[model samples]
Target chain A: MFIKLAALTMLPVALVGGVVANSSVMIVEVDADDVHIIVPVPLSLAQVAVAFAPDEAKYIQMDSEVGEYLPYLARFVDELRAIPADAMLVEVIDGSDHVRVFKEDDVMRVQVDEGHGTKVNVRIPLASLAAMVDAYDEEENMFRASRLVGALRAAPSGDLVHVIDGDEEVHIRMW
Target chain B: MNRKLLSLAIGAAMLLAVGATAQAQDAGWIHIRVMEDEGTSVNVNLPMSLISVAMELAQKHAFDGDMDFGDEFDGHVRFGGRHDVEIDDLRRMWAELRDAGDADYVQVQGDDETVNIYRREDTVFIEVDEDGDDKVRLQVPFSVVDVLLEGEDNELNLVGALTEMANTNNGEILQVNDGDTTVRIWIDANPQG
Candidate 1:
């Protein structure tokens, strides 16, 4: 009888800064001229949330089908890891935007400059990205997010992304 | 005789009330939340102890401690090639699976659909994914299965299963996401949330 009442209710979804200090956490902060927000989420909670996400959010689809490139993800990451840090993977200047993708130390970094105090920077450990990619479940056609959560526990801790756009600034860090 | 029966009813009710109050103070709660994108949402919070008290009352009055449900569900419980097995056989298989510990039992993959049945620790999970329109995840503890299968033929011990669930830790039991609508059932310690 109680289970039948499920159609009549909803849940509180937002989770912020509610985990142990030593646990792996992802912090997202947005500071604008008008508003400020910060959310610190544990990786375990992220995995649990994935279980509640729609299928579209679980799988990464390309032109032909979902996870079509899964088989080659490891190989691609491996090749990238083998490249020298001094090598420039991609550099483009279009209009006022300047983009650069390069290997630095053990991680790959991408920086985008839009001029006038607008800049976007992303740093990701190649190994950690590969670990996340390996979590894909071939049978389910989706990622087994729990595995990704487990992998994130050992990932290098630091700022993942930082962006400054005019009067707004956003930062994402994992630790 | 009427007076005696009335006194017994009052005593039982009072006993249940006291027990429920004591348990509710410490026991966990079961929470269910369902929502739809750009639509109304609902949240239901039920005390685990309250359900336990109700189940105790039900055991004394309705089920009478019976747990064996008949092995004739007359339904198809698909498990790869062993899709058409009997209920008793399925239980036997479950026992085997549980003994073997955590591992994938069945995996069915299609062009636009997939189903996975696996066991993790003391729980079993059945997950179904059909493109972007539908996704369902079912999680049940091993004890719930044992209690449910204890009933006599053709009957499931739903009461026992629920009783076992009341004892389960605050964790997720089931979740379903279909397009705009999402439903989740979990247990926690907060009675108000």
Candidate 2:
């Protein structure tokens, strides 16, 4: 049976919470036919405030002016939550220093620092994902197949991590 | 040297340069739009020159590594070796099978039954039969089939045909209604002089 390509419009939803100050990292792996995304989520408001509060100065002022920071933090969390979980079977592995998030039965795992961030791992079929994304926006569809493979090919061996600006809509890095 | 001859030659050369630039600007483009009943739509624009460049690049790297086409049209067509053989290889294989008369209908093994693919004149038919019962039959035009078959060769014959049709037929290239979704592709040519 031919699968119908549908647009995926589910944005991340916000989990009600306060903001905390913390640091965190996200990792993603793109394979031949699948994509694995891993993100660390901080449970506490202080950690969430610190990890995704736009910037350090704004984060400092967040405590003084709570209203201005709450909405931004909520939006960030919502975007993170918007990462599609339907296409993946998720598992959360909690540790003392870090949390490990991965797809069920996936052998690959990333170590996370404890109390730093929450880790979320999602595995998606690359072809299906590309088709779905293409159904929505053809111009951006190529990134799923072409740019992804090119980036994976160019990535150096070893645990290399490159941090882009945190304020970006999707702040994912490869490790 | 005669000044008149020199002036004429300079003027001719400038005219040729301008003609070349105009030709470059007049090159055709394909626009594909997919729409669903749910009010979701997507638009894609593909330049003919870019497709030509990608075809050349694919030919160049056909034996080593992977050749990626358009970013939005995306995906790598890997060549060389058995393990990395991609859709391009499969197309050639199917075409050869058809040529050899062994594939008037190709049988695909399913979980509990067999699916048969055969061509009837201009339409390719896919029929699924499970446990001695006919399950499903689908007929698709040869135009769409040609797109898939000729895709391995990096030729956009279907798009070219659509471009020609759009040029003549009031900008309506072709539209296919599969269930509730409609897919339309046309050529938005550079305005004529």
- DockQ of the candidate models in sequence: 0.01, 0.01
> Stretches of candidate 1 above 4 Å error?
A1-19, A48-64, A93-97, A151-154, B1-193
lDDT per residue (tens digit) for residues B1-193 in model 1: 1232234334433323322333443565555565656544545554545444443334334433342212321211112233254556756776787789889988999998898999899888878777776666667788988876664433444534544554674455445666666665555576444
Model 2, residue B71: what's the lDDT? 35
lDDT of 1 by residue, A1-175 (tens): 6764653442222223344444678889999987999998788777767778887765543443336554455655665565456545455555566777777877878898976689999987777878877777766666665667765755678888999999899998887
Q: Which candidate is the best by TM-score?
A: 1
C-alpha-based local distance difference test score of model 2: 0.38
Q: Least accurate stretch of 10 residues (summed lDDT) in model 1 chain A?
A: A7-16
How big is the positional error of residue B163 in model 1, measured in Å on the Cα after superposition? 74
Q: State residue B67's C-alpha deviation in candidate 1, in Å.
A: 66
Give the residue spans of candidate 2 off by over 4 A: A1-175, B1-26, B50-64, B68-78, B82-96, B99-104, B107-116, B122-177, B186-193
Could you give candidate 2's per-residue lDDT for residues A34-132 as a string of tens digits? Answer: 433455432243333434445432222223233433334333333223333321211222333333332222122233433444323323223322332
DockQ (0 to 1) for model 1: 0.01
